[model samples]
Target: MAISFAQCFLAVDDHDKALAFYRDALGLEVRNDVEFEGMRWVAVGAPSQPDVEIVLEPPGAGPGASPADRRAMAELLAKGLLHGVNFWTDDCDADFERVRARGGEVLQEPVDQPYGVRDCAFRDPSGNMVRFVQPRGR
Candidate 1:
């Protein structure tokens, strides 16, 4: 049997704003957007990676979390303390320019890392750091 990544999540304060950045700016496609169990369930994925999806959810959305916990989580999110995921792109510089042109907050410009990848970073509207990386020589 082979194991593979299926889904990961990012805490989003507003679903629509997240979509505008992920879909409109980052060029991810919305795979699912529906309401379930009194909550909105939204998922987005890179078109090239159908099996990998990122779920956009509210802070402390787990069933066991209390109101205070949710508020704390929200505060952390607003403070840019929550970790977001990194994405691999075929063209890091092009993607970086696109995101920047669309008004994404630049955290870092593209640079070749010692690890042998060219990468850049931006902060989403909700303050989550989103990174794009490309292997050197392509």
Candidate 2:
């Protein structure tokens, strides 16, 4: 048996702004954009990892969610309480500089972690904490 990740989701309040960060800043390729049932989902992925995708979706996009649930989710997303994604890069400092130059909100500069990786963090347009990591000694 074999299992692998295909998609993971992040909640965003604005699709265009998220696209600017993920696609333009982080350099992920846009895989799909679709609207259905009054909700929109945009898929983005690293070019080298074509089998994996991150879906940028509106808060509370799940079915059977109540209005109150949606509101709560929106509030959480606004507060940066939603879970974010981490990406692996070959060059952490270079990727950090590129994303910073492209206007991603810097959460932390590149630093070597005690856990054997060098990483940096940035806030996506919707306040999700995106991180880039490179294994040390690479």
Name the runs in model 1 displaced over 4 angstroms. none
- lDDT of the structure predicted as candidate 1: 0.93
Best by lDDT: 2
Q: Which candidate achieves the best TM-score against the true structure?
A: 2
**Estimated TM-score per prediction?**
0.95, 0.98
**Residues 44-71, candidate 2, lDDT per residue (tens digit)?**
9999999999999999999978999999
Instruction: Write down the RMSD of all candidates, one decimal each.
Output: 1.1, 0.7
Clashes, model 2: 0
Which 10-residue span in candidate 1 carries the lowest summed lDDT? 33-42
lDDT to native, each model: 0.93, 0.94
Candidate 1 deviates by what RMSD?
Answer: 1.1
